[model samples]
Target: DAGVTQSPTHLIKTRGQQVTLRCSPKSGHDTVSWYQQALGQGPQFIFQYYEEEERQRGNFPDRFSGHQFPNYSSELNVNALLLGDSALYLCASSLANPIYGYTFGSGTRLTVV
Candidate 1:
């Protein structure tokens, strides 16, 4: 009964570099969603994946992409990173139905120098 887990709890990258964040959904969860949370701000949806396909996306640019594997694990890739992209990347997992809220990971803090 583990919760969502994200790797590289913290990362430091430079502008123009690319970074990939990883996440493993909780047991029995089939949907995975990614969010970006800036300091003192709420989490902003990036995209959601289900059945190994992207089902919904947020206002982020194409540089932000994600993939869900058959095991319900997921990855978030950001290309040409910008300083503004520095934030806490959160991964959440839940069932397709909204009967229950999402279970979030500890989050990956990215800093672009």
Candidate 2:
């Protein structure tokens, strides 16, 4: 009965550096999605993962990458981080299709100094 879990809770990175955030999906869920939420802004979908593959992506640059493991856990990797990359990174998980429902983690607050 575990819900989605995100690591570090908070993070701080320097511009031009790289960092990776992790997420463990809720039980009974097979899909994972990543989102970025800037201060005062709604979450913006970054990408979706299903069956260990990237099923869909949003309007983000190549600097963003991700991975889904056989265990259904996922990771979000940001390279050459910029100040704009600082935000709350959320991880949501659902069934095969998220149109039904999903659960979100508290997210990892990232700050690019």
Candidate 3:
């Protein structure tokens, strides 16, 4: 009965650098979604992965990319990182779609210094 799990609880990157964050969804979940949360702000949807394909995307630059594996694990990759990319990266898992709600992890704290 493992819940959502995110790797590298914290990350530090330099401007122009690239980083990848990994996530393993909760048991029984098949859809994964990524979000960016800034201080005092609600989470902003980054993208969603289902059936190993990107199903939906939010307002973000091409620098942000993602991948989903057959086992329902996922990865979020950010390239040419900017200081503005500093935020909390969250991974949420749902049964088949997000409309039913999601179970989230603590998130990865990314600091772009």
Candidate 4:
């Protein structure tokens, strides 16, 4: 079974530009969650999507949004990016409610220039 995968393993953006990162979940999974990890910090939950709808959202700003497709893949979109947005964007997949350990893809290192 194919595991989760993310595009543009690394990305660079300016302070005000918008960026979109993509993710494909593991085979047979239906839930996808996004996390942000700052240098020296643990990954912070941004949001989670299931059944093509957002199921849970973290304390991130309105500028952070996401979408999950019927295929169980997902994309994270960030607008009016700030320098603080520079971090590792991680995507994790689970079978259902995420009570189980997640399968995490290699994160996309985003740098706000």
Best by lDDT: 2
TM-score (all chains, Cα) for each model: 0.98, 0.97, 0.97, 0.96
State in Å the error of residue 51, model 4: 0.3
- Model 3 alpha-carbon drift over 4 Å, by segment: 98-100
lDDT of 2 by residue, 11-42 (tens): 99999999999999999999999999999999
Assess candidate 2 and give its TM-score to the true structure.
0.97
Each prediction's whole-model lDDT (CA): 0.96, 0.97, 0.96, 0.95
**TM-score pick, better of 2 and 4:** 2
Clashing pairs in 2: none
| Candidate 1, superposed: residue stretches over 4 Å from native | none
Candidates by TM-score, descending order = 1, 2, 3, 4
Q: What TM-score should be assigned to candidate 1?
A: 0.98
Per-residue alpha-carbon lDDT of candidate 3 for residues 67-109, written as tens digits (9 for 90 to 100): 9999999999999999999999999999885577899999999
Clashes of 3: 0
lDDT of 4 by residue, 1-113 (tens): 88899987999999999999999999888999999999999999999999999998999999999999878899999999999999999999998866768999999999999
TM-score attained by model 4: 0.96
Per-residue lDDT of candidate 1, residues 75-97 (tens digit): 99999999999999999999988
Residue 19, candidate 3: how far off, in angstroms?
0.4
Give the better candidate number (2 or 3) by lDDT: 2
| Deviation (Å) of 25 in candidate 1 | 0.4
